[model samples]
Target: MSDAPHSGVRFRGVIDLDEHKVHDRPTIYVYEAPVRAWHWTNALAITVLAVTGYFIGSPPPALAGEASAHFLFGYIRFIHFAAAYILAVGFLVRIYWGFVGNSHSRQIFYLPVWERTWWAGVVHEALWYLFLRKEPKKYVGHNPLAQTAMFFMFTLFTLFMIITGFALYSEGAGIDSWQAKLFGWVFNLFPNSMTVHTLHHYGMWVIIIFAMLHIYAAIREDIMSRQTMISTMISGERQFRDDRED
Candidate 1:
């Protein structure tokens, strides 16, 4: 007997097996240009901050020559400062985009905590990840659990870092500097600049952890979930593996 008949292939929601024709997948443009730009820029800024921040915490051994001969520590601090400014400015721009950009742009900033369905979706997503559910639901944008994580881990923690970081910067900037003027209030909360430094250091680790989780989730979802994840940021298109509504 001939081998069992091969299952027909489904291409772009249109089943076409015999001809081997190419077809467009069902897709939606979710992330706009500005959102994508901010995403990549923010990622770079975070990476720079993490590396420089690590050096800031545990500096390298002293060089053999004079301090002026090698500005390794100075260069590290400069990079850290530059990346921090970029992160803060990008965050401000992201918030502005949330106001003017598409609906999905605001998802991270606004959590529909009061909605029963949203909480249920969060629970279902959790269960799905726990292997208690057979399938995960498809979403046009971030799933409820992801939205929650973005809000708490990225959004809130970013704000916390900005405040603490600038507070530490104000010490070198002098009491008259604008950074001091604007973020001096942070010092009032912690008083000791060392405490602020410690908090900022911990925040860096937190962001690093968040970045790892975010990347892993995206890659995993791209393969396991019914909807696109990573390509959505690069191409601004979210394509469903199947047309069935979740």
Candidate 2:
């Protein structure tokens, strides 16, 4: 196929491009170490908070032994309080990391509301979830709907729970304490401390619902979308099934 004399190079050769099938590509480094650490740490803290917080709201049947000696209820409260503090501190550290870490680290913190393409992605994701779309798009970070849910359902609700929780703690710590100094303003909005307590309780349900969806989506997308999901958070690397750019 070449015009040049004595050249051994073949100008071209034809091959079926479709003959090759690729199941993976070079992995993208997405979540950083701090972000991944905070993710699992926050998950554990959330699980403990939800379970113990539920019991704090609804007590189990009394123990057979003397109530004076047993501290089962006290233990539950301690665990719940400890987990809440862990979650709050983790969230704060995550926020700081968002500013200093990789761009993917900040995906869950904000929405691109002004972008029409982002809106299209939201609709596309919604349709995919409903089984109306045949194929799902690949993303190194969260898809649009997941990002929205994270910002509203997880992030805001986590902040609400922290503030209200500390305000409730301020009652025992007294109005003069540091907890009150920081979160006492939350009382001004609710007026009744019990009202804040109830709202905080409801926030737990919202977080639980979001968590279920997050888990289901991760597992589903890992199988159906041909991209790594659950493992991405664990190893901070995102892999796609194809070389095609998103």
Candidate 3:
């Protein structure tokens, strides 16, 4: 029998029709191990960076003991730096994976604005989120609107953060250090370190907002959409509610 018209349910001709049973639909491996690894690692790094970066900007109450005995702010800076390095390395590895991984892997790097159909999909997804559409289209990878946000919002801002982050680091690394030589140009635009520091602080908040939205969207799609979302990242498998043609 043909798959049931409704999603997340399938037909199986059996002796008992009264009992409803949901059959497993078609599934495909989407995310690779490297992609999943980078996702979690990047998430952790962003978390640490955001939290400690905030404290670095506005430190907590001073400790009672001597400055030598209290390394509270120092330790916070250390964690922020460590997390920044992890984020930078993970970003590089993720870029490499995009080149070698499956076609779905590079979905976030750019848009398919040339294609009329892709634009159509983007509009459809936007309306779906706005409750203007009844259903969301199923895709093995990210939908068009999501790709746009991931590319423009997440990826672009991530690159910005790395650049500014390194430039700020070059301050401590000294003028002769490699970081200073490479990223010191960032200082050229804003000679005052405070200006860059303010921008960097705001960048952290932007990323934090993106993270919250990303998580909310993932969970929402996982529940409301036809395909798996959260589990797909963990297991690299995307299971559709129905075996409908895409």
Candidate 4:
């Protein structure tokens, strides 16, 4: 019995010769193009809103002897409102996609109230990241945790923006304007619109924190799993292990 014959029988692929190359096999596309486009567009809009919002919320020390320089504040307000409109459009499109899009993008599947398996999914996902398990539970789209976060934050922030935005706009429209009347209930509850405005300003920090965490998680997954997690939000394709089909 020759050793050469035994070696030929035992050989697999490049992995059989190299231990370090023992990684998961690659899978096909995961995210779609629309989802990616929505992500980046929303990101840009949010960035603009944050920068302009800071100026709109608190004016800097006035430049000496330039009374007309107050237009800087006016421009900040204009950009903030403009970005808000763009963000609102992106938000509406995402909602519509959640209905007509693929199974992963479907609103019913992502909504916490509707997804029966979401609780288990959350636990499994957490364990997956914590390294408690060798193989992670797979989802074709947003994981349970992400689905819940996006839904809650998007809904609450949109309402907050609308209520506070309308309240502010109503000031210039006069108390009798329809805008004022429509938001009259919110103002009545708060009594001081400035307080509501302050809350709205503070809400940006919450969104920023969420964005930071989201980006970090995406990058971490990409590096660890060899998945194109971040690029999927731009190029709309995620490569995963072939065995990890969801």
Give the C-alpha lDDT of model 4: 0.69
Arranged by lDDT, best first = 3, 1, 2, 4
C-alpha lDDT score of every prediction, in listed order: 0.89, 0.85, 0.90, 0.69
Candidate achieving higher TM-score, 3 or 4: 3
lDDT of 2 by residue, 132-223 (tens): 98877777788888899899998888888898999998988899999999999998898998898899899999999989988988898888
lDDT of 3 by residue, 66-103 (tens): 78888898899999999999999999998998899999
- The sequence of per-residue lDDT tens digits that candidate 4 reaches over residues 1-246 is 001222233335655475333444445565567766877888898888888887777777676767775576777888888888788777778778877777766642346665668788877778877888665555557777667776667556665776777777778778999879987677777888888888878778777776787788777776764345776766666655445335
Per-candidate TM-score against the hidden true structure? 0.91, 0.88, 0.91, 0.77
What order do you get sorting by TM-score, best first?
Answer: 3, 1, 2, 4
Stretches > 4 Å off in candidate 2: 1-24
Cα RMSD, model 4 = 6.5
Please give the range of 10 consecutive residues that has the lowest summed lDDT in model 2: 1-10
User: What's each prediction's clash count?
Assistant: 0, 0, 0, 0
Clashing residue pairs found in predicted model 4: none
Which residue runs of candidate 1 sit more than 4 Å off their true CA positions? 1-24
Candidate 4, position 238, lDDT: 63
Scored against the true structure, residue 103 in model 2 reaches a CA lDDT of 87
Cand. 3 TM to true fold: 0.91
**Candidate closer to the true structure by TM-score (higher is better), 2 or 3:** 3
